[model samples]
Target: MLIPAHFEDLPFDPQRPRAPRRQLRLESEGSTASGETARVLIHNISTTGLLIESAVTLAQDERIELALPEVGNTAAHVVWMSESFYGCRFETPLPASALGTLELFSRVISKAAPSESADTLPVRIARLRKEQGLTLEALAALVNVSKPTVWAWEQGKTRPTPERIAALAKLLGVNEDELLSGRDGNALAQALNQARQVVAEAFGVDPARVKVSIEL
Candidate 1:
């Protein structure tokens, strides 16, 4: 469970210290663009703008819709984009009901530091490997890949192929889509891949497997 990170403390005065922006892992389920649902994580949020770290890539000015649990789907526009992180400004402010729910969730998160046990790519891969009782060597053999390849995935040094992810899903008893696309899919994944290429140089691994959202 990857918990979203939020700021601590709400100020009594309206101008007092507002809650720090929260980092949210959000899923955009259905929209006109993506026939299927999409998952995304919002790294930071403020009244004016939102910084999202998505597994997919989005074009500038792309129309995006987000589904907040209590808020339902809301519309936004992509104002900024890097390789992995994109910024969106809400087209219309959310309803009071939805804002209330978000406030409540933020308060709860503010009281506690983010739990490390929450969602992480490495943890996901480790759990999958453990559940399948497939040693790194075993999985490597199954995939007709080198042991280092399997090791890379486990260590967050690489990511596996969608094909391999499909196979691994069956072995680990998890959804193929979840494995192939940890949170973001479609365009988001494309953007994430581009970001990984730059970051991979420091890590000496393929951006595909060791992708921050998707495990190698």
Candidate 2:
């Protein structure tokens, strides 16, 4: 389960140390001048939420879509914002695969090895759906897909289409990226290496940079 210690209505102090910034584009906070897509820089992120720099002014609790690269378009919620930066949380806490993706992009460059056929994506799907208390038939009916299709998805005999991935993410309350990739021990090691930065936080600070109120 995820904790509500994000940048929501919770108590926030703007003196926390944050992870390195990441450059990526995604869809969220509604349509922009260039359509519904918004290109933003991620300041910090965790399993629970992320802090990003965006021009979009998002109201509290506003839900939006994001086309995460490698990952997919996922539903996200705005918890709080200050200046050009906003704190947002995934509708569902991201899975390890999605976290690995974040860890990959947070760096200046990344190289990934091909994965084995015995990937964890299918396992993740099965686990998430069961956690949601939906049987194969029930989930298939909910998504207008056949039971065999759902079974294939769970068995890794096939993968979901982008559109279906979007639907699955929303239906299962997860980030689309979390549904897209699966990894093994190597990916886990990389994620851990990328996440080595320790947080430095306190209550007081100068007004120059955006005060880090929440921990990632």
Candidate 3:
């Protein structure tokens, strides 16, 4: 051990179990131990562990589930926390080759899903617009509304009238109730559950394995 001063810069360690750890920055949806769902930004991840940054406060040893890229719904326990930053160790370690690679994930979702309903109008509209490859401005122009108005609809800020709802539903190829069903989280759990099935089909995965939270 005393004869290795010149090898200090070498990033490899023969004593370590595997290859060096790599880093990735990605976004995901996580459910807290308290059953609250929030958006989380994954700062870095490896087969054994990951670091997450979120607005939600987490406690030490709290159990949480993260919908990770490539990997599916992975259960982890919070090993450490400091305000909005937390560290975790996966309940079951992933394959060494599976970590730090969202570029591959991007390829997997390159083909958009077909028109389908979602848990809320905002989610439905957002999903439809993405499927049709339309941006906010484009959708707004086609709908004869301001960009903010379209955004408002996507955020559940305001629900359109029945006539407007009909037009939107027709435009998105979804039923009106899919858009109006949950004005604001009114029994959206059921709708989101159904939407997960559609998402699974769209991505050619099993419904139970769809961990990305079926977003808009």
The lDDT per prediction is 0.58, 0.58, 0.59
Best by lDDT: 3
For all predicted structures, in order, the TM-scores are 0.33, 0.34, 0.31
Count of steric clashes across candidates, in order: 18, 4, 0
lDDT of 2 by residue, 151-215 (tens): 66885546888898899978887777766664344565555543442221232433333223424
TM-score-superior candidate, 1 or 2: 2
**What would the per-residue lDDT of candidate 1 be over residues 65-156, giving only the tens digit for each residue?**
55566756566778977555677898777665655455554454343443347555556767678777888888878777776566556645
Q: Output the worst ten-in-a-row residue range by lDDT, candidate 3.
A: 1-10
Worst lDDT window (10 residues) for model 1? 1-10
**lDDT score at residue 1, model 1, on the 0-100 scale:** 18
Tell me the lDDT of candidate 3. Answer: 0.59
Best-performing candidate as measured by TM-score = 2
lDDT of 2 at 205: 36
Cα shift from native, residue 200, model 1 (Å): 49
Q: What is the C-alpha RMSD of each candidate to the true structure, in Å?
A: 21.2, 24.5, 20.7
> What TM-score number comes out for model 1?
0.33
Q: For residue 147, what is the lDDT in candidate 3?
A: 68
